[model samples]
Target: MKAKLGMSPIAWWNDDLVELSDDVSLEECLRQSRSAGFTGMEMGRRFPSDPEVMLPILKEADVTLCGGWFSGTLVNEELAANKDRIEPMIELFRAVGAPCIVYGEVGRSIQGDRSAPLAQKARLDDDEMKAYARKLTEFGEWCAERGMPLSYHHHMAAVVETEDELDAFMNHSGAGIPLLLDVGHLVFGGGDAMRAIDKYHARINHVHVKDLRLDVINGLDRTKQSFLDAVALGAFTVPGDGSLDFEPLVKRLAEHGYEGWFVVEAEQDPKANPPLKMAEVGYKELMRIMTAAGYTVETQGFPRG
Candidate 1:
């Protein structure tokens, strides 16, 4: 999988440096990404929510927009108001010329507490999975008309999180719809993150290269803390800084012939320290992993010492 590495600029924000208001140095972020040798980037939501402002920046940076993310809450309900929900996002992606949108399926969860005395979360059976797939397939077809792919992102709060749920989601979600797999989230959600990579490698459209700290996850209060809280607590970090085996991960991707972007997204505060240092750590480790797996960064012809 000779993929380009891209970074998200959320790490570039400094709460104190700027009120995080009128302007953000999007150009500085592009410089950082180019400096890091990435060929593409996942534009930050704050960078430019409107295409008019963002298009020029992306063109100037010479980086491709490796799809943006749109999150919604749906897991326990059938996708109602589906068109109303996704249409704007479809238009947004089309307006910006992004080839795809890394998306997650979420709905309200059925807390046994919906009545309260018992409250154990229920599961989605195969029938529901198929229905969900049909709905997703419809969306994919719609996006296809516009040359945009809605790559289903399997997130923690999603019905497609656990292994069984993952199986069901795959079983039902339309085939040929590209999947934007996130390694860290899969591991956090207690799924064998690499198994699917090897099994359904052909459906992969893009990837979010997030790494996890199993220890942090293992310590969570399984009942109260929301998935977002866990992420906020540093459960995720850039690859190589955590406990994940990239050799097999990459091998499986290569075996499947994946040619997409591995966008490195670490939801940590860079200001607590320095963004570049962590980025350096991330870039070096990413290169090491790629090199070990025999995938080079298509080096810019200045031979080495």
Candidate 2:
């Protein structure tokens, strides 16, 4: 299968935690990412909303726009209101030829709250999940009809966090709502990436190749520490620097015939773990695993799914 390697700008310039970000321009971020051998990058806070203005900067760096995060509120807000909020992103993604928009359900999310402990994360029972999933399916279908699809991101402190929650969400949702499997977040939340991949392979439209510092995660006091606190304590890292053995996961993806962008999205203090160094580590490790898994890694540009 054909796979493309991409990098998220979070590693260079974090949006949620600006303190963790490196002092760099968008051009420099793209330059460093391309230097590390990534052919594509996800949109970040620094990226211009206008595609006409953005395309030249990306072109100069020899990278394509892969995918980016969208803070979605479909769970708590009306469809019309959500539609209005997402219209600009939909137009931007469509204009840039991005594969899919990463829809992170941040309606009731505590991920950005530095004081909110991990234990206080939002939750929804079966009935609530059913309604939320239905709404997501409808929203996903609407986005697809407008020329892009939503890849639902099951995030760290979001509503659909653990394996059970993800299962419940997927069970209730239709094919219209595709999935974005973020392995690090899944594993950090006590979910097995291997098991998730086995079950949700068909629905997974995008992949985040995030790796974790298991020691940090294991040591964190979830009852006292928030998601951002865990991040500050160095909970996440690039592939080879972390505890995950990505070879097995990549092999599993290859077995499932997965073909899409595998974006390296390790957001940490750039001063501590320099973005360029970490990006190279992630790129090399993914390359080795992708080759081992029989994937032809695309170098020139990303393929539109």
Model 1 worst lDDT window (10 residues): 110-119
Question: How far out, in Å, is residue 176 in model 1?
Answer: 4.3
Q: Tell me the whole-model lDDT of each prediction, alpha carbons only.
A: 0.67, 0.93
Clash count list over all predictions:
8, 0
Model 2 RMSD vs true structure: 1.6
Can you list the residue pairs that collide in candidate 2? none
In model 1, residue pairs whose N, Cα or C atoms come closer than 3 Å (at least 3 residues apart or on different chains), thus clashing, are 73-106, 73-107, 74-106, 74-107, 75-106, 75-107, 112-119, 113-116
How much is 132 displaced in model 2, in angstroms?
A: 0.3
lDDT of 2 by residue, 1-305 (tens): 99999999999887888899988999999999999999999989999999999877877888899998888998899999989988999999898888899999999999999999999998998899999999999999999999999999999999999999999999999999999999999999999999999999999999999999999999999999999999988899999999999999989999999999999999999999999999999999999999999999988853434
Write one digit per residue (lDDT tens) for candidate 1, span 1-305.
Answer: 46677776655652222322223367877767667676666756556766677777777777667777655444444445655676776777677667688766646442112131111334567777787766777666766776678788876655677766777777776664678888887887778868878766778888888888788888877666656556556676777787787668876787677776777877665555245665677778888877777675653211122
